[model samples]
Target: MTTNRLWRTLSGFNLSTRKWTQVNPRKARSQVPSNLLSLTSWNIDAFSPRAIARAKLILDHVLHESKPPDIIFLQEVTTAVRASLLQDAGVRGGYLVTDAEDQTAFENVPFATMTLLSRARFAFGSDSTEASEDDEVDGEGDLMIGRVSRMSLPSKYGRDALCVDLIKPAATGTSFRLINVHLDSLGHTLHYRAQQLEILANVLRESGCGGGIIAGDFNAISPEDEGLIDMNQLQDAWTALHGETGVEGATWGVGAKRRDGLGPGRLDKVAILGSKAEAMDVLRPGSIEVPRPGQESIFLPWSDHCGLSCSFTF
Candidate 1:
C-alpha cells in the first residue's frame, strides 16, 4: 500500500511516518512456519451466569474445531471459574494469570483470572497497576467524544489484563508475545485506552522478542469509528490480510443486545508490532469466509464480546 493509503487506512499518525515506519517494514516473505499458530481472545462476561454457559458452549465449539488455537486469551473470567472449567474440560492450560484489581472484591473475590491459555511454552508478562477510583470506571460524561477527560489514567479495573510470550522450539528459537486486554467499557475513553496501549507497548519492548502480537477486546472502535485508536504504529493483522470489507469480520455488536448482529464492527483488535514480527497476517479467516475446520464458530457467544485471533511468523 502507498504511504497515503496506509495512513488513511490506519487513521492515526501522531509520529511522523518517516520516523515510525522505519522501525520495521512488511517482510518480503511470511515469518509463519509450515504449522501455523492460532489464538483466540474473548471477554466471556463470566460475571453473568447465563454468559458462563454460553462460554462453555463456545469452548466446546473451539475444542471441536479441526485446528484449535494453540494459544487462547479469555477475559472477564474469574480464576476459580477458569480452574474449575479447565478441570471439567480435561484440558491442561499453562501459564495461567489473573487480575487483582480491587473491584474484584465486590463479590468477595480478589481478582478475575483473565486467563492466557496455551499448549506451547509460555512466558508471562508483568501486570499493570489496577485503577482505584470509582469515577475512573464511570467515564466523566465523554462517551461519544471517546477522548480522555481527566488527568488520571484508569487503572485496569482491579482486573489487570494478561499477556503471554510464546516461543517456537527449535535449534534457532523464535519467540513472540501475545497481550490480551479488556479496557474500560462503561466509559468509552480513548485516552484511557491509549495509556493502556502504552503499557502494552512497553511490555513488548521489554519482551526482547523481535516482534509480538497484541490482541484483545480493546473496547475502542476502529480508525473508521470517529472515537478510536489512531493505530498508525501497529499493523492490523485482519485488515492487512482480509482485504478491507466483510461481514463475518467485525468482532463487536451494535444496539441493545451485546452481540446483536453479523455486521462487521472491528472493536476487538489483533495488532502486530512493526518492530518485532515479519509478514504478520490474519489466519483464522484465511483464504475463505468459512473458519478453518476444528475452529468453526469457536468464538460464538463464548463471551458477551466476540473473539480476535491472529498468527505472525517471527
Candidate 2:
C-alpha cells in the first residue's frame, strides 16, 4: 500500500473509545511555531508496563507544556506497545505514529524496532490553508511526509533503522531527514557497532539532504567508538550542548545493581547533521528511582536508560 493509504488505515484503527479530530492547519500553526522544532529520543525498554507508564507520563508532561516536542523518536518499541501507544488518549489526540519492526520476529516475543511519533498539528509540509472535514482524507496539511523506509542492518537480531523525510510548509522545498536506530545489543562488540554505524553514515551521506538527525540507542560507550568521529558533518548534540563537563550524561543502566555488572553509562545519543543545535538534555522524571534491598535507596530511572531531547531552530 502507498504511504498515505497506510497512514490512513493505521489512523482509522480505533483502539480507543475517544473520538479524535483531523489535523487542523490553523490550530496547528497557532499551537506550534513554524520556526521551532523540538524532538525527544528514548529507548523505552521493550515497552514493559512500567516503561509504558513512565513514557506516558513524560509525554503528558511535555504535551501540557507551552511548547511540546514536535517529533519523538523511540527505540526498542514492541508490537504490543505500538498498539498501546496508538490507543493512548493523549497520543491519539496529538500525534501520528509510524513504526518499523525488526525483520526477525521471535515466537512469543513482540517484534522490536524503532518508532517515530509526529505531532499532527506541527507536522511539516503543506501551506497555512486549513482542510475542511471533507478534505481530511485528501492528506493536505502543514507537514508533507515523504520517503519512509526500513533499512536492515547486519545483525543476528535483525536490527533495522526507520528513515523518514518531512517538509515543513509543504510549498518550501526545505526538508529534513530523521533516522531512528537500535544497534546490536551487548552481545555485539564495538567493532560490530562500528560496522553498523558505517552503514548508517553511508546512507546519510548518500541521501545528500541539507540537514538531518540520527538518534537512538547506539550502544557505543565512547564518542570515539561507533565511527562517530569519522562523520565530520554530524555533531553529537550531548557533547555540543554540555561539553567536557557533561561527561556524566549517562542514559543506560539506571535500574541495574552493582552486582549486575551494570552502572550508569551513555549508550543512547542524538547526533545532529547540518543543523544548528539550540539545546540538549536528558529527561529524568522526579518519580524514577532505583531500589536497594534494605540498603541506602538508589534512584532508578523509568527505564534502564533515560530519555534524551534536543531542540533545533533552522
Candidate 3:
C-alpha cells in the first residue's frame, strides 16, 4: 500500500504515454494459453445512493462468478470503492490492482474512474538484480504485472484508459494490452464517445498486439455506436455472440431500478480489437438489503448499470 511499490502484492506504477514504452525489466513469458479469457465491465455508479454497501456486493459478485473472469473492468470507481477493493481479500489475493491514488501515474481528478483486475502473471529477466525501485515486480521472478499505466483521453469529465500490459509474449515477440475505460457520457450522438473509442483503438493498433481488449462503460446509447467498431478496426463481443438485438445482452437499465423513464439500454459494453467468445451475459446482482435507521430493510440494485461479462480465448 506504500506509494513506491505497486503490483508488489497491490503496491508502484509508472506513467506510460503511447505504447509499451516502459523497459521490460521482466521479459514476458510464453504465449498466452489457448483458453477462454473472461472479462467483465461495469459502471458502479459511485456518485449515487449507497456506494459503500454496493462496493462490497460488487466485489462478492464478480470474484465468485461460476467461472471467474480473467480480467475485470470497473468504472465509476470512487475513492471509497478503490479503498474497499484494496482492503478486500479477494482482490489482493486474486488480482494486481492499479495505482489510481497516484497522480504521477494515473489521473486522480475524475470524480469516478476505472480500475482493472487482472489474473495474468509474468516472469522476470535472468538477472535477479535487474529490477529497479520503480519496477513493479516481486522478489521472485513470477511478477503478476507486466506494467500498470494510463493514457489521457479527450473528455469533459476527465476520462482516461487504465492500460495494463499482460505479459503473454507471443512467438512474434509482442505482448498485448488490456485497457479499461469509461468514455464520455454527455453527447447524445457518437461525437464524444467516438473520439474516445478511436483513441483506445489507436492504442491497440499501435501496440501491434492485434489481440487486445478495450472493455468498460462505452456509454453506447446511440445506434451508430456499433459502426464505430468498423471505423476503429475492432470487433464487438456483443455482436459476435449474442447478435445485435438480443434483449439478454442489454447491460444498463436491466437489473437495476431506472427512474429516468428510459427503457433498458445496453450502455456498458466489451469491444475487442480475441481468441474467440465462448459465452456472454450480463451481471445481475438482483438486489441488496440495506438496513435503515428504524425500518426493517430496503432492497436496491448494486449499480444503476448492470455489469457485462464475456468469455473468449486469448
Candidate 4:
C-alpha cells in the first residue's frame, strides 16, 4: 500500500482497494495441545530512570511467578531500559531477548521500542526444556535466540511492532509467533487508531502464519472501538475467556499518585489469533505495587500501566 493511501485510511477515508483485494482467509495450520503456556505483556513506562528501576523490580518479581511466563512482550521500552533488563540476573539465565525501535522517526521522541523475551528455543524440533533452579548454576540455559523483525507504523512518534518467532518443540510440535506492539499513544481518535490497526493487520496477513499471540499497550479505551474491529481474525484473550461486560478491566492508571487526567481504563491487552487462549486461575487483573528504593514505607505502581499476564493453551 502507498503512504498516501495509508494516511487517507487513518484519516477516516475508506479505500476501495481493500474491498477489491481478494485475500484468502487464513486457516488453522496446527492444533496446539493442552499444554499451558504463560504469556505476559506490559508497558514499562520507561521515560525516566525511576520508572525503569521500578520496571526492573517488576520484571524480577514476574520472573519468580509460581508458573513463570514462557514468553513476554513489552512496550514503551527505551534503549537504557532494555540494557538494564538484559543485564538483570532475573533474565540472564534462560531468556532470549530481542528489541526493535523505529529508526525512521526522530531521536527526541523518547524512542520507545517493543521487546520480546522467550525461554523457548528458536529451531523447530529442538528439545524444549523448562528452566529450573539447577539451570541457574550454569549462568544460562539452552534457549536459542529467535528470529526478530520490525514493522514500522504510520505514526509521528516512530511507533512500530516487534515480532519474534519461537520455533521450539511443544506437545503439538509447532512454532509460535509473538507480536509486541504500541499503537499511537497521542492519537485518541478512532480513525487514528484504525489506521494503525490497518497497518498491523496488513503485517499479520502478510506474515502467513496460521496462528500466534499479539500483545501490547493498544492505548484504546475500548476493544470494541471501530479501529480495532478490522482485526476480526484475532480474538481478544480477555473477552474470549470472560464474556464482554460493561465493567472496565482497567489496566491503566490503577496505582499512580497522579492520574494524568486519565481514569482507569483497559489499554494493555493480550490477544490470540489462530490459537486458543485460556486464562489461568492465577491470572488476576490488577496492579502490582513497587516500593521506593530507600523508602520502604512509600510504594508506587511498577508502571503508569499495570502489567498483564495470561495463560494460553495454544
Question: Which sequence of candidate numbers ranks them by TM-score, best first?
Answer: 3, 2, 4, 1
Candidate 2 structure quality by residue, lDDT tens digits, 1-314: 11111121113224444443234323433334444567888777764345666666665665676766777787776665665666667766666656422223323435555444555543422321221222222244445555566666667666767776655543344456777877777733566676677666656555435567778888876445635634545688788788744337878765456675656677888777667678888776535544467898655445666788788865
Candidate 2 overall lDDT versus native: 0.60
Clashing pairs in 4: none
Tell me the whole-model lDDT of each prediction, alpha carbons only.
Answer: 0.44, 0.60, 0.63, 0.54
Over 184-287, each residue of candidate 3 has an lDDT whose tens digit, in order, gives 77446468788888877777766445467888888877678768877887888888887877557777777445476666777877777645667778777657
Higher-ranked by TM-score: 1 or 3: 3
Judging by TM-score, tell me the better candidate of 2 and 4. 2
| Per-candidate TM-score against the hidden true structure | 0.58, 0.74, 0.77, 0.68
Error of model 4, residue 212, in angstroms = 1.6
Model 1: how far residue 146 lies from native, Å: 36
lDDT of 1 by residue, 28-120 (tens): 222334235566666666654455465566565555566555556666665555544544432332222232122232254333434433323
Candidate 4 per-residue lDDT, tens place, 1-314, comes to: 64221100001111343221111111111122224567778787765347667767678767877656767777777666765765565565445445321133225657555454433322211111221222212112222223455666677566767765544322123445667778777435556567766665555455434456777888876445523733555677777676554334667755444535656667777767656776722223223454566876454456767677788764
In model 2, how large is the Cα lDDT of residue 52? Answer: 62
Poorest lDDT segment (10 consecutive residues) of candidate 2: 1-10
Ranking of candidates on lDDT, top first: 3, 2, 4, 1
